[model samples]
Target: MAASMWRKMRTYVSRKNIHRLIFDPQCAIFSMFLLLIAEVAVNILVIKKIKYTEIDWKAYMQEVEGVVNGTYDYTKLRGDTGPLVYPAGFVYVYMALYYVTSYGHHIRLGQYVFALLYILSLVILFDIYRKTKRVPPYSFIFMCCASYRIHSIYVLRLFNDPVAMFFMYVAINFFLRDRWSIGCLMYSFGVSIKMNLLLFSPAILMLLMVRFGTLKTLLHLIVCAVPQIVLAVPFLLENPVGYVVRAFNFGRQFFYVWTVNWRLIPEEIFLNKYFQTALLILHVTFLILFFVFKWRRLYPGVGFGILMKESPTALSPNQILLPLFTSNLIGMSFSRSLHYQFYVWYFHTLHYLLWSTTQPPIVKILVLGVIELCWNTYPSTVLSSSLLHVCHAVLLYGLWYSPDYTPNDKNLTATKVD
Candidate 1:
């Protein structure tokens, strides 16, 4: 059995095979072609004709108009929507779009531009996975193809979510290389676009904590947080109460009846302030425990050495990052109510986490089926909502406990491509 295992390992990482893969341009071009085709087809067939006319788009367009005319007032832009819920940095996207459409109020044209940006977002995502070289090419391609929720977030809704996501992933790619300051700056900018990017804050915090001292980590976090503060200053100056209400409106009641997280629970229970408080407390506690466990391998050699004696201090940081990314995103999914559009925030990363596991094919399929069913349903049903959270919990549990790759185990990563 030992000999057979050694033989399989050798075959998986043979130097000769790695060299051949490095020069495979045909494979790279084929992958890019397929990705482009998928993006174009989805935009043309599904998104263009969808009659939903996302209410959110109307609100965003109003803000865009206000900005372009030099009369931008977040407090009064979308009267029906209460106020602009996002930071002022997003005004720039609409400003550019407004110019592109020749101020003809061409919202559909803006959607097309957003669709292109979304495609670029996926390209950056693929590049990140390629740099990590852990996910299989076929699996990465499959996840990219299956991202209908992400597609809707982009072309169908013409959301600010994708713009934030594009920034977040670009930051992740930088952070993966230990470029802490630049990554945090990008993350900060993403947060400025839409605060939903804060869902991944714990992951960034964990990564920073693992590599640097507390003082440096704190400094970096402050640097990261500065952009959002600066962006909000003008809005706050004009209408302090409005800015406060809109920017940090977590306690606001859900206006929509159809939601992913709260759909399974009774409506009263879902809306209860106490229930929300309990979830927040539990989420914070779970995150603290997660952070501690992640630092176990780096614990002091003075007194705790015996406890983590078997843990490898020399292991690559990606092992820690994968869990940080998985746990926080799953935490976000369950710790708060998820609207129909929120799925895009973590779907791609969640798929990567799912496939990273050694779960059986049947199990992965069933889990994916449950997730897809939940998101694909327009008005999410009770069963789909319940299963969605259940599936998230399962993925979080599996990723939390999954074995980390050792020096030998990491040899199983995808081969380099030239």
Candidate 2:
């Protein structure tokens, strides 16, 4: 009887039925339950070792309360504390949390809520991949079981990166379905949460323009701007310049030790204004060259035919561009004063991009295993700055070279799996 049952189970899990097993609600539920337990264990370990107060949760709470009470002064905040760089929508999230936690006195409650949100974000991400039907077998499972480096940054450290990434993922999901307006709104909301998202704005706008044409794209952009405008009304009326300068220009230079590249360069280089200017110009030129060459190879269009041809569908251009843009942004962030927790931003994008490819399951597993090793070593002394720089460079290069599946592909059938 035992031998017969084993044979039956093996037969049931064959390639043809794998999809059913993978997407089954019961499977997802069980995976999530396991993930929750693991995450809770990790969170407990981190909080105990690092100490809750050292992570800046209290300062973040104070900042949010300050914004809610209308006593928030941007200029003063930036001067006295570090940059108050997050968007108004982020403030709202914190405010809601504060209200529920009774002004953050209930730290455990806040941590629990963030933990749940982090888990929910992963579920939504899996749903988005499942909707594509192109997600390789075991991809979602790998993502769930991967190291805590990225997810912990949000859940344990209590940062807004996860929340912003959630919006980005939602926006991409809507965009994939050709829901341009809603996607644009979500994109706008993501940007409103953190200016880091501004890096993706141009790509999102390009996507809208390609999908809806110029006039309609402009109208959609206007509509998308409404939410941000409404949220900024008070700040705009009070001290527009201060808000703009603080929110936009907060990270204009490098000062912190946690920033990645800054640690590599000499202090003299960072202190010199001209050196910074030169580095900025060099970085911009390199990125432009990379994109130009990439585009020329991937999609070469005739004059009028370009507008008429359908946009790339194997993961929209935005999906392809986002990971690259985010990697570069993380590089830039590291070149400035990046906190240890800020590494979450890059790892999240990197891990997602790795799993999203059409590569074989073994290849995905191998790559993720390497990344997991690196991530696990990050907090320890084993992973040095030079090692991290190389890893990041490799991931960014992979992102740039990875196929995003344009509509121009001859093999793409009418089923449209992307």
Candidate 3:
């Protein structure tokens, strides 16, 4: 009787059915929920153990207030030395928050709001992954279990980056859907939130030119600039040069102790004015090389026609979405001033890329494992600045090239037909 029962059970569980079960969305959702719970527990521990009172709540509150009241002066707020740093649209979001909270007194309330944004970002990331056809269920599960949630917690204390990342993802979503005009508008909104995104503007322009051709692309680009122009009209009229200087040149003037790469090299070398000039030149040169030499050849027009040749059933919209997503993630990694929370933006992108590739499973696991470990260490405060910077630079550089040479087609289809 026992042998008969075992045979029946084995017959009922077919190999094909088991494979289907493994890849099911229900399984993925359950796994993500458990991972989220674990992450929240860890965050609670980190917040409780750390001295939360050490944060500059008063200064943050004052900035929040300044952003709410349009009358608040940037020069006075920055002490006449620092640039405005943030774009004007950020003030609008803060103003909305202020109104909602009725200008709440407690700083912890602001922290909680930031935390909710972090959670919303995670949900957006999952949507990006689900929309990408080439991504595998297993890979998505791995991302859910990774260090992305931990990084979000670190960003919760610093509100600006979370808001910036949210807008960046919004821009990416629009771009994926072939809405270039809307994408550009979202990109402008993102830059307004944080000037750091300006680094990726060149890449954005290149993508627009490629997708829409010359005249139309130029027109769209101009349209996108409208927001910035309107926001700056007041400052521009008051002092054009000063406004330009504050908007563009301010970040270049001051060096922060928390800057990652500066600590890696010799202090004397990093401190020299010539060193900054040389570094700027080097970064620009490499960025140009990436676009002109490496990226151009990787796409369809440059003789990789075989790679670009669409699958018989593949939708053009899907084909376009993959590249759009790739460009955004690569752009973010190349950006300067990438704080810890910015990792949330790329988690889904990384998973999609990994799932689409044909690389051995072991290699994927190793690379992702290392990335998670590095992201988790960042908020620990145990690692030296030099080490953190080195790790960040290396990981980002590695990620940019990883999907380029791989042979996965998960991102090539509009939807999973199987």
Candidate 4:
């Protein structure tokens, strides 16, 4: 059975395709048009003056002033009190921007740089979609450019998300290419900037364990973790207790009514120490279970030595990428709290997970539509949040279960991770 599944996976990836628009030049144009549409939408928001003060842009600009003054302390941040919620690695980006221009150019400079990073991420995503040969090229582009979260990354909330996300995109791109070491290194940088980047860490662990083995995976994890530890050093030196508390404050909860998730859930549950703890335990348990099931199911009757000799899947890491992405997403989907900007974390990845499924096209469309609606709405209603949560479970469960073997399928499942 193990040999047969491996053979089946091999044949599936090797099958040929004859799609005309897969690599057509106009596909790029269509992608750009979708981005333009999102830009127009953001411009409309700018005109309304709705996003300027409330969007976190003003706060971001203030944070950079910390760099300009020679104190790199995050405690100086405006709006929010105490030390910065972001990791110290982000200071590197602001520090560079600080030397380049005057105070007046801070926000705009940050915007332009972050926008470019986001564009680069999109370009890489476009390439991944194009290579998949499983989904309509146009559909993936629409999801990428049409997202409100994507719009916010560039036009509204000017935080370190895009920069951290840029490293994630780069890491995934390298993973797709079978440069496992390089990919893991790049992933370290993303995690260093923001621990959220570690959402994909479970998937990476699975990949490393499969492609290398238990011992090598341990080594890779050490390699990946070193950077995160190093990045925290400066902040740790300034105020060890404060930095650790602020940086890894997993216990800290949010009650921002503006957030989409948990609005309908009684604030009592959100504040309930036990409920939050259960969710964290569940999150860790979920990853371990997913990893075990996948390992047993895919490599049945095979030992680690033989497994590493030849990957069961035909493609190098394509099968790994889909689940790697979705598994991490599964962690986020069940998060105790998800903020508005946090939606940016999964917008494109969820779309990719959607494409990986063998579910009916309409179902896929509705799932994406529901997720888009949930995030796009400000102060999301209970109805949309419920829909978003359900669809996330449905989409992730779909992506988590099987890598659709159909030639038209690009999504990796239990068989492949997208």
Candidate 5:
């Protein structure tokens, strides 16, 4: 029996099979299963050992309490933290949580619910990687295990960032599967929860124009807009201007103390209007370069006029995901500030973007590790902020030089959804 066991182990550990397990997309299902099991165990351990940090849970409950008690005016809601700035979707989602957890008294149960959310988000993300086949199976290990910050954001802190991101990924999945209408709807739902999802609007707009003609694209835009209007109806009826200004406050400045990305900058400069304007300019510039040059390589020599005509050519999974992910990255890279909780906004996409780059494998791994290090640093220092910027620069640089995507479909008839 000992000899038989040894032989079986040897067969499983053979070099070729191990290679296939890590390098092959076919192994993603098996890899995801094992990772998820480990994640469940980790969550259980975290809950059992780590004390849940109360950051915004109480504040969330208080804000929603106002809504529950018959307040619809966006500017009228207030909690311990500040005025209720999130949209009506946030109110609805957390209101459900409020009732489920015995009026926000049940913290552990909330953590468990978020743990489940974390798992579901991973499943959708894994599906994305499997469909794209852009990253190797081993990259999943880093995505699942490398970041303590991500786990805490979802479970311990109970920030609404993860909740908003959940819908965003769902929308991406739908878009990749060629269901544009449903995808737009889901994307709108995400935006109603928070505005960060709007970062993908530029890419999604380009995609809509390319896939459906200008007229059809406008219909899809309406699909995305209708949800926001419907969700905000009550608040809008009470105070339409307040709902627009408070819920979708684009000029809202973040506190310097909470900033994870701009700690190197002085607080005064960080608060200066010029700094914010500069960041916005840089963000728009980088996006223009990426959209016009790198992303358009899939349809070389095709002008915007022709693209608006809706060619029947199908986009590959990589073609669909690359632009969208890159758009978000550019937005995050130039963001005026990124709080610790904001890590979830771009964490899952880092692995895909890293592998999408032309950097050496070792360089890719090191960049990811440095980024993880930067995020893990509490009350981030000048050194950490600098390191984070360096890593982002490396990723952007690599993506630019990376090989152009090779479409799965050679013919223009269809992009593969399967």
Candidate 6:
């Protein structure tokens, strides 16, 4: 019976189109499993062979150490790099790490732990791709094995960026599964770890409003806010003003020396308040346009007022994924400054976003290659920064014109390589 079943399966697969095979959901799953196994070995090899570069790990330990040693005042908590600027969840998470890794001295164990996180993040991301079936199987290789910077960010640098993103991706996965309440909770947890996760907020808000209507969306908003309130209670008790000011400071100035995305602009202009204001305007403008023209096209003639009172509608998986990722990408494009460690913010979403665009296959591949090169360039030269912007423009254009897939659209499930 087993042999017969295997033969039948082989025959069925053989009859399918070769291109379909490459884009086959089953093939994608198989490739993901293989990559996960290979990634485990690769992470181990990276930890063993490469010297773990200490950029923010020690500072993270110090910040959390203060909380563990009974310091809850956000103003008083200091690390080697600077004061604790991240939210309360970061404190709790790293405090656990501090204890487990021998008061934060066990560096090797920490690397191994982060390696586990990287794998877990990939698992969540793979599940998202599997559900959407937008990108082909080969793209998984580039996502997992092609980028040295991603590996370094996860294991070598031990930046809190990956930790926050791990939760963010979890939230995204849950959103794809239509578990909005849990997704909001997980998203708030990610925000608690680091503020960068908030970059996905505009998109999340749009999704919630569409899926649950206005009143229920407020309940979901409360679900998101409660975790943040619960997490910050300790710090809030010590100094409510300080906790609010430091942990979620939106006006904090970024150091020009470490910026990865704005090398083409002069330092004076980069530091100018007007420059940031302009970027903020551009960001808002792009988001509004996307929401009105692109995302809302899924529900034609459904205005904001209508959507507010309308019955809850089940969204296509890609509908849930695309806007959130595109929103982040737009934010990144207009960001004040992007440090090297910030790559993890949108790295995992690149493949999905690229495949969602209407650009030619070669254009998509070139854009991906240029982006990888741009991020990998240390201190980011003028040419690299310019090239990065060009790539971003190309992608934004492609996404703008790309076909919108409705919930009942047959094309939503059609997997195409080109």
- State every prediction's TM-score relative to the real structure: 0.81, 0.76, 0.72, 0.79, 0.94, 0.93
Candidate whose TM-score is highest: 5
Residue pairs clashing in model 3 are 134-410, 134-411, 356-408
Better of 2 and 6 by TM-score: 6
Shift in Å, residue 176, candidate 6: 1.6
Model 3 bad stretches (over 4 Å): 1-57, 67-73, 79-83, 102-104, 141-145, 148-155, 233-240, 250-256, 297-348, 353-359, 375-418
**Candidate 6 Cα deviation (angstroms), residue 205:** 0.9
**lDDT of all predictions:** 0.67, 0.59, 0.55, 0.65, 0.87, 0.87
**Model 3 reaches what TM-score against the true structure?**
0.72
Candidate with the larger TM-score of 1 and 2 = 1
Q: Every model's Cα RMSD, please?
A: 7.6, 5.1, 6.1, 9.1, 2.5, 3.7
Ranking of candidates on TM-score, top first: 5, 6, 1, 4, 2, 3
**Candidate 1's residue-wise lDDT over 86-187, tens digit each?**
777787766676688666367677778877887788787776666545554444454666767766777777777778888988888776666778989998
Superposed model 5: Cα runs more than 4 Å off: 1-13, 405-418
Tens-digit lDDT string for candidate 5 (313-393):
656677777788889999999999999998999999998888887788789889889999999999899999999999999
lDDT of 3 by residue, 179-249 (tens): 66887888788877766566556666666655555667777888779988887676566566665665555
Local accuracy of candidate 6 as per-residue lDDT tens digits, 97-126 = 899899989999999999999999999989
Ten residues in sequence with the least summed lDDT for candidate 3: 305-314
User: In model 2, which range of ten residues has the least summed lDDT?
Assistant: 296-305
Determine which window of 10 residues in candidate 5 has minimal summed lDDT.
405-414
For model 2, the local distance difference test gives 0.59
